[model samples]
Target: MDKSQLLERVIELVVDITGEDEVGEELDIDLFEEEILDSMAAIELLLAIEDAFGVSIAPTELEREEMNTINKIVARIAERL
Candidate 1:
């Protein structure tokens, strides 16, 4: 799939995991500090993204910066692809 499609899927999977409808929300909003994502939820997100994109996220890639926001995560995944 394309980058945009991958991003959309990521958003959908995040919403499912976080139980939020973020369609009209800000992409750069911090889900962690916002309390929208907890530690367990974050792990699930990482797993889901890896599974959906068929790309592995290395241990060195587990920085909080890369996962700070939805936009950033999507960009990271796109870079991997």
Candidate 2:
């Protein structure tokens, strides 16, 4: 998938996992800082991202800070893709 498509799917997964539509409200907002996502939800997100994009995300390969926002997550996934 292209970056925009990837971004949309990622946003959908994040919204579903977090049960907060607010995630879509700000593409650059930090989910952690906004309390829209927690550690458990983050794990769920990682798994969902793997399933949705067929891309593996090894925690050791990157810092968690790289996943602090939607755009950043998409960039990471795009790199893996």
Candidate 3:
């Protein structure tokens, strides 16, 4: 998928995993700061991202700060893709 499509899918996964529709609409929001993504939810997100993009996200490979926002998550996935 292209970058836009990848980002949309990431957003969808975030919204689905977090059960927060606002996250899908706010691309730049800090998911952790907003309390939309806690530790458990983050694990779910990483798994979903892997399933969706076929990109493995080794937990130790990324710092929480590096993947705390939708934009950052998209960039990381795009890079892996």
Clashes of 2: 0
TM-score for predicted model 2 compared with the true structure:
0.90
Which is the better candidate, 1 or 3, if ranked by TM-score?
A: 3
Which regions of candidate 2 fall more than 4 Å away from where they truly are? none
Q: What are the per-model numbers of colliding residue pairs?
A: 0, 0, 0
- For all predicted structures, in order, the TM-scores are 0.86, 0.90, 0.94
- Rank candidates, lDDT, best first: 3, 2, 1
Ranking by TM-score: 3, 2, 1
Cα lDDT of model 2 by residue, 1-81, tens digit:
777788888889998998888677689988788888778888898889889888877656767678989989989888888
Question: Residue 62 deviation, candidate 1, in Å?
Answer: 2.4
Error of 3 at 72 (Å): 0.4
Which has the better lDDT: candidate 1, or candidate 2? 2
Judge candidate 1 at residue 50 and give its lDDT: 78
Off by over 4 Å in 3: none
By the TM-score metric, which is better: model 2 or model 3?
3
**Segments of candidate 1 deviating more than 4 angstroms:** none
Candidate 3 lDDT over residue span 1-81, tens digit each: 788888888888988897888886778878889899998998998899888889998778999889988999999998888
